[model samples]
Target: MTDDDPISLPAHDWPEFPPGLVWLVGAGPGEPGLLTLQGLHALRAADVIVHDALVDGRILEWRRADTQLEYAGKRGGKPSARQRDISHRLIELSRDGQRVLRLKGGDPFVFGRGGEEAQTLVQAGVPIRVTPGISAGIGGLAYAGIPVTHRDVNQAVTFLTGHDQTGLTPAALDWPALARGSQVLVMYMAMKHLPKIADALLAAGRRPDEPLAIVSNATLPGMRVLETTLGTASHDAEAQSMEAPAIVCLGRVVLMRQAIDWMSQLQGNPPRNPDPLGGGARTTG
Candidate 1:
């Protein structure tokens, strides 16, 4: 409601009378129910919603019939709207005096480039607002029964992208420190080059026997988690064949899945056999 203080509730509670401009809203992951009240409000009030492919369809139900909807998804290694073009479009929409809603998956600022869009709008002298949503790193992990942090395992968590456009790990990433630094690691858009990323972590001193859980289609009804050790995650994921729009988590906290495998059991699926080493499997790659 005030500067230096962000509204912490869901999208619905956001102040109705907003500044004349754009609002970058996160739609959470794939689940419609996960949408923040603020996100819901944006959907209803938006004159236009330029959204990504990752956003669920049902969330649009609350919108007025005349609201304009546009797509601007950027999947890894896929054709997407150019970032600059998208930014320019946002400016154009706002210049028309339309309340624009830039809907993104997960928290817009968390790897969603919401900040970049915000910067562009600000530089263009367009007013902008932000609303946070559930990040895949956390909500997605929960779908896989992998906790980001546990008092017994990790007190801290780290989030990173597994690779860059070249299909190689990001050189700018201080991997050596990150690999050795955080107690728990969560990676987004890492499936394509998971092997290289995993190897980097191993070389950087993380235990190969560490637990890894790859949650695909997180928070959706079809969400799947491949449990493995760091050394074998890539292979096992390949063996069973994992798909994208996934989240990968690593650390001892993953073991909690054993007691909390209720999602699987409810679906009549049983746990797989334990590895001979008494350690869980890794599946980042």
Candidate 2:
């Protein structure tokens, strides 16, 4: 096999990608290798792929040369296609006997609006297949050596979008409840309103010095992880020019990154701290 050739997988037990069916596949974080086997199969078999803004371009290289690629990504503060129109186009394409693939970043159901699209397809009597992918809230954090749930840290985790349809902080969220209820909070697209979110959490009794980590371009070559406190997250991100397409993790688990940053270990750089919890020093044999 050559470098340009598409990575192949065993076809055994794989479902056939028939015409007039829409497959909603998650592309995982930003790493092409993270694409699920089912997702890759859909990519190769689909006649057209309607992908989101976060789907990495490298993953598209696996699709057949003749497959049609459509952009229906919706980014904050940008001019983008309407959700209804995008769903309508999917129905139109499938009705035209094309194998339609809706590729989204992370799990489609996790703040990716895959549920809405699935509902639209079902209501329109369109056949569809759903493929779940690793969410950024979990997988992205893992890439940064931050676990969403830790036995010693958090027993519960909450995942929420930073904004609602109006492009503002979700007003319906009970800030006090979230502050006290969830042990760890994973926020998506929260960079735009980080300061406001921090203020709300602080007002709700969350500690100002609560540990937080912002992971940018997660699982990709340019991935960056910033460790800061809840009070300083907004200002620190701005001072460092942290960009979007990032994941924000808030809780004690953020401290665990100091001990288990395995990616750095691969390059002969040991973790900065071996005992993040301060239980005792861990010895390397």
Best by TM-score: 2
Instruction: Estimate candidate 1's alpha-carbon lDDT, on a 0 to 1 scale.
Output: 0.83
Model 2, span 241-269: residue lDDT tens? 99998999999989999998999999999
Give the candidate number with the greatest lDDT: 2
Question: What C-alpha lDDT, on a 0 to 100 scale, does residue 14 get in candidate 2?
Answer: 88
- Output the lDDT of residue 196, model 1: 86
- Please give the lDDT score for candidate 2: 0.93
* Cα misplacement distance, residue 124 of candidate 1 (Å): 0.7
All predictions: root-mean-square deviation over Cα?
A: 6.9, 2.5
Give all candidates' CA lDDT scores. Answer: 0.83, 0.93
